[model samples]
Target chain A: MKTFPIIRVVTKILIPYILLFGCYVQFHGDYGPGGGFQAGVIFASGLILYGLVFGLDAVRTVAPPRVIEKLMSLGVLIFAGTGVLTMLLGGNFLDYDYLEHHVLPGILPTGQHLGLFLVELGVGVTVTAVMTMIFYAFAGRVQAKHVQAKQEPTP
Target chain B: MTAIDVAILLFLAITAVTIARIRDLWAAVMFTGIYSFLSASWMLLLDAPDVSFTEAAVGAGISTVLMLSTLALTGTTEKASGAKFRPIPFMVVVLTGCMLIYGTLDMPQIGDPSDPIHIHPSPSFVERTQGDMHGLPNVVTAVLGSYRGYDTLGETTVVFTAGIAVLLILRRGKEEDSKTGGRPGSAAASGDNA
Candidate 1:
């Protein structure tokens, strides 16, 4: 990947747009044909493409394994936590209608939109972390094997 | 179906057959990606843009890359089997496919307003989302995110679980490496088992 200037340059140019599109898919999902699942996968693909082009170490540096592991769990927590919050606010589990406030009538009808946003964000976060982590695991295995083979040449 | 739908479906069938017949794993993976893209197009033609988007991204983009990486770890060419033509599995597959086609005989036509799905709370969700969610525009998002929120939570949990399961199977801890005498092949061995 480092040797091919054309491939490297094209990948570098494409990555930012991919990330931006992922953001657009995440945020614009409410009004468009995308949601957290698609957005997360898209974002992960962008990072994976970067990893494929620049190498596993580069991607791992960009998204550390420890942080990704935490994020993998944190997304589920964020989603479940929202439900718990709604329950505490005198609503049924995941009942976003109760999320509405008389104070901020201008925001949107009920708390449904905000609740959706948070839940989707959680989904997006978890998905991105998990997908990227999977890529790292697989690619890391190949890298490890490559190093091992180099170290020990079979006669 | 329209001409475009027919064309896409034709391409999808050809790609699917190509993938099944191709002995080269890399070409098969590429063909599988093409099949997914065609399926996405067909989904779009059926007016399910959200499903199409998901199919295109996860099916075509991510799965292809994942399969390619898996190929990197494993053999790229499938080994030739010594067995002769097996009729039992072929008959079973044909029988199952026939049964599935027979089952679809009773299904409602595409976009039929009188379909069972179009009735029974579908209209209610679509109607209420406008007022309840304040004209969110994308009713599918509203349904998934709000109306059927619990299901989405469950799905997120499912994704989380899958990731954890994969990590457990593949990820090698430093302690495990030392315990296994720094055998790099152990991870690949476990992955193959998985």
Candidate 2:
């Protein structure tokens, strides 16, 4: 893989834009065709491409497995916490109406806009973590099997 | 159906048959990816851009990579079955396909304005989301995020649970590896134990 300078160079140039598009899809979802799920998959695809090109060890350094495990749970917590917060604020479960605070009055209304953003963000985070984690698990198994094959060559 | 629709469907059918007939697992996976891309194009033609976006990214992209990785662990060539032709299973498949096609005869025509789907809560959701979601232009987002937030929460939880299940099945702790004298069992056997 290190011998493929062309692939390495092209991948380096393309990754940043891929990540940027993922963010665009994530935040602009309210006005566009993409939302959290699509955006998360796009983002994870970029990382997966990097892993495919540059070894798994490189990707593990870029996105540590421990942090990904924690983030996987954290995204769910963020989503449920938003619902609980709405409840605590004297509303029904996941009712975004209570989130209206009149902050930045002339701009977008605070309630549904803010709630949707936070909820979608939660979805994006969890999806990205889970997709990356699954890739790691599969690739790790292949690596482990290769190591075994090297240590004890079968007849 | 439109010419473009027919063309895509024709390609999709060809790809499916190729995947089934192919002996090489690697080629089958690649054809499956092609099939997903064609389906995504068909979804876009049906005027559901959001669904198309997801289908392209997940089905065409991530699924292909994951299948390739799985093929790396398993052998690249599918083993030949002991019995080449099983008439009972073939008959069952043909019967099921005919039954499914028969079931579609009762459904409404595609994009019929008088259909129940267009007449019911869909219209109300579209009308209300403008006011309720503060003039949000994308009704799909508003509906998923606010109107049916609980369902989305459940979906997210489902994804989380699936990840946890995969981790439990695939992950081998460093302590377990050392304890087992660095000779871990096959993934399936260990997964069963876990």
Candidate 3:
């Protein structure tokens, strides 16, 4: 990977656009064919491509393992916590109608949209983190094995 | 079906057969990616854009890369030690295929309005989504995010749990290394030591 100048150049050019498209898919999912799951996977693929081209160290600089671990839990928390908030707001669990209640007048759909957006965000975050972590674990372990294999030939 | 759909299906069959025949793991992984793309196109041809999008992204893109990473951990050449064909396992596969085909014989034709799947519960979801679900035009999201919110929550928890489990199993820190006598390989190394 380090020796391939063409891959480095092309990946650098393509990655930003991929990330942007992932964000578009995440946000525009309500009106389109994509949502958090697809968007998260796409976003993670961009990072994974960067990792594949540039190496795991570059990916770590972008998103360290600790940050990824925290983000994974936080995403689930946001999702479940939305339901808890709805429960506390005197509505049935996950009832988005309660979200916009009394805060804004005359816009009945605001709550549903807001709640859906937040939930999707949570899902997107969690998925992105998990996919990246899985890649990291696999790639890191393989790299370690390669180093070991090089250092000590099997007797 | 259109000619294009038939052509794509033929391509999918070819790819599947090629994947099965290929002994090189890398080629097999590439063929799997091709299979995913072809299936995604088939989904689009069937007027299922959402399913196609997911299939293209996750199946073709992410899963292929993950398999490649797994190949890096293991070996690229698949072992041919078990190459001898056994008739019993082949019979089981044939039986399963026959059962699946027989089961599908009872299914209603595609898009039949009288189909039980299109009749019950789905109509209600469709009816209420636009009006009561605050005009979220995408009925799929309305159903997945709001109507079946509990199920989605459960799925999210499942994803989180899987991530946790994988990290716990594969992640090695300085602490783990100290306990394992500084060998960074998998349990194979530990087994050898014992």
Candidate 4:
């Protein structure tokens, strides 16, 4: 098989695992050398690498700039919202201990490990979108410059 | 000095020399990438995986590529600055290096658990990080996002600011029919039509 389809097939097979690994890193960060920041970058890098191999046009068709912008802003909000929720729940911002609470009367609850999970997910979204945005920005610049040069008459 | 230390020092020296001597801006950028790659390796050997990873992405990867593209948009030829090397500034830099080396002479041995960084507060930081924060075993996040979160916030802001600045410098210029590179007219702009 040609490399493009092979890569597509391989990445298709691997996307789920890549996502799972990202989750693992984000969740297991408290004990390891990785956490949201590293996991976010790695998650974003996978998509960026995909774009590099496949082409920018393919990625843009799948995730348009407008959608990406919305996701990017939404990601920031999601991250901030978690912190806001913790504050509303009478904890300091991002305080997991405060998040570990029984919402219903006398119900047992696990500590708010899920809070970090959500935060990491948000971070991953924002990071990937922003990195792609950066890539596109430069890509656009090169296009614009080339167009201008071509249109210009000889000196 | 240890072998790793010597290698780091050697690369660091080369980095400085390359920065000074490479007349072409593109080569300077590539050398800087090499410098960062070497530093990442050194940091890995020193058990600072997080720093190494960050350096790899931001320093060697993003920064190098960005600098090269910027050079492409601008010019690769280094403009001649017609100033002789100032002896005073040279002496000051030399003095600073000497002082830093002298300070390192009294540092704790590499990887000494009894060192202040290891003994005084780090253990407690480690111990506290485990029980506190979200359940992720990555204490770096615990420390970064929880314990000393302000610094991490600052770091994140730096990433955000850099992203914005890059976007701005690289904003699409006006394009005409003859120009092949402009965003909208080009085939690669949004990729949807493509």
Candidate 5:
């Protein structure tokens, strides 16, 4: 079932483009319409498409469950850590103005720019991980159920 | 309203009715995706491009896929037992719909610049984004990331907690293995095996 030629060919052609677009949306969110939420979903959709075409095991191989588990928390940590860093830098929580105190006075805006990028990246990572984790759990449970049904015949 | 707006609205109404009437859960999921796509177009017409983009991606794409995956785990055929109309539930639904419609009557006209919501922080957010907020072109990002940073932080935490909850409930690996593998010929496992 995973080896269907048409699906395999089309998915192979489309996956990289979809992932690239997801990254574009993630970064361009500051100037454009989409943001972390949308980009994360699009990114997860690319992986989900891969899962749908190549089966659950293939996706697990690409993104193991343990790695997904860590990513889910890592993103949150990054977001909160940014805030804590701001606080430690003698500013209010999440205050990006204090991010680059050592930089030249003329480039103060760099702090805000970098801060926004990191915050958005954190949001994107967490959302992508959660969505993929949920899909994996559901799909894996179903697949395991099917596998069990096949392996052990019912009386 | 423009012709395009009217046409899109009419299609939305048709899709809603079809979704209600469709007996097959799978078809209903597809129709729901269509409904999201139509509403996204309407949002674009209403000049909410960001919202439209989100509606298209989350509502139409990811949600449709999730619903399909759910259908794979559940029954595709919706039960037909609801044919007999229950007057009490019907009245409840009608009353809720009427209340919702009445609630919208108090809303300011769409795109009214002077609306209460547009008066305070929004004007400042727009004005100051170019100056105090590091001259960011996207006022929405500036507002969300800086002005309302606390709110966004809380929202991220909420999402994190939801992920944890789903993992806890759905990823019960050991329990599931014990349930299925421990009793292969048991009635519950056997019923599911078929």
Candidate 6:
């Protein structure tokens, strides 16, 4: 495999920290300042940084373009599906009060508290996957351009 | 004005000047990305973390990349009409900025509890939000996901739509190699090299 020398080592070190920060952002959304969207994008951005350093081909090896595309759609579906569920449950669209089907030992909590968590998860999934898909798409395009330029005639 | 407010105004000025002055279309676009990142930071300082998060994720990251891709797909950079002064547009922008600044003079300070925003049903929602809603302790989240659920859903749809539109336009066309300048008709010529 071709190496980027300095960039590769630097990104490798930074990747783990970015991953940790992203998780903190995700879980900490409820307490201070953060949410699914920020966490997801930051997480995807760290992976994208790795892809950039090692070259696009390596990224495709782990998360191929077709798979990334499918995951993006899946995220949207998960988010929309939750909303549709709320609609069917006799509440307004995205009314998470209906999502209070979580199981606990004794009591069942609803709406603002427990339901919001699931909904945020849906949002987080969609935002993150879609972001990664976008980065992959562009890298694929760049590679395609490189190959095409090579194929051109000199005459 | 507070230090953060001053910083935000400085960003707005930078964004405006960057938009106005940059000749290279690519550089201008990058400035817009900078503008977006700054705006997200400003919003965070304004106590609107949810909006800040959305703006940072969508504006600073995905949107900028998509814009750069569009520049790649199209060849219309053409250097922007030889950098004309364009007084009419400049005056309009300055006038709009002045109007905005003038209007802000009468507004409440950031985080002021009596600022009409926090004092309304918002406070009621903030106060009794957890008890009735049950498990969610975060009032900001509670408002976004439950009370203003439709708005949040709409925002998600908007994000999805933007992504889909970019994907559609950038998708590999039926002609295959045409997008990257390797149309199928040229395949025969390349094969002749073998």
For each candidate, give the TM-score of chain B. 0.82, 0.83, 0.81, 0.75, 0.79, 0.72
Candidate 3, superposed: residue stretches over 4 Å from native? A101-109, A153-155, B81-92, B175-194
Instruction: Give lDDT: candidate 4, residue B64.
Output: 70
- lDDT head-to-head 4 vs 6, winner: 6
- Which parts of model 6 have CA positions greater than 4 angstroms off? A1-3, A83-112, B54-58, B67-80, B83-93, B120-122, B173-194
**Every model: Cα RMSD to truth:** 6.1, 6.6, 6.7, 5.4, 6.4, 6.1
> What's the lDDT for residue B125 in model 3?
62
Categorize the docking of model 5: acceptable
Going through the candidates in the order shown, the clash numbers are 0, 0, 0, 18, 0, 2
Docking class of 1: medium
Runs in model 4 with CA error above 4 Å? Answer: A1-28, A45-59, A101-112, A153-155, B82-85, B119-123, B133-136, B149-158, B165-170, B173-194
- Order of models, best lDDT first: 2, 1, 3, 5, 6, 4
In model 6, which residue pairs have backbone atoms overlapping below 3 Å? A113-B135, A113-B136
DockQ of each: 0.53, 0.54, 0.48, 0.36, 0.44, 0.33
Candidate 2 C-alpha lDDT tens digits along A21-129: 9999999998888888889889999999999998776677678777889989998998999999999999998999888896678676488888888899899999999
Each candidate's lDDT (Cα)? 0.86, 0.88, 0.84, 0.66, 0.82, 0.70
> Which candidate number maximizes TM-score?
2
- Write candidate 3's Cα lDDT for B14-129 as tens digits: 99999998999999999999999999999998778778877988789889988998998888997777778899999999999999999999999778988998887766767777
RMSD of 2: 6.6
Task: Pick the lDDT winner.
Answer: 2
**DockQ, Cα level, model 3:** 0.48
Query: Which scores higher on TM-score, 1 or 6?
Result: 1
1 against 4, candidate with superior TM-score: 1
TM-score of each: 0.89, 0.90, 0.87, 0.76, 0.86, 0.78
| Model 5 Cα lDDT, one tens digit per residue, B85-131 | 78999999999999999999999998898999899655675777788
Model 1: lDDT equals 0.86
lDDT of 6 at B20: 79
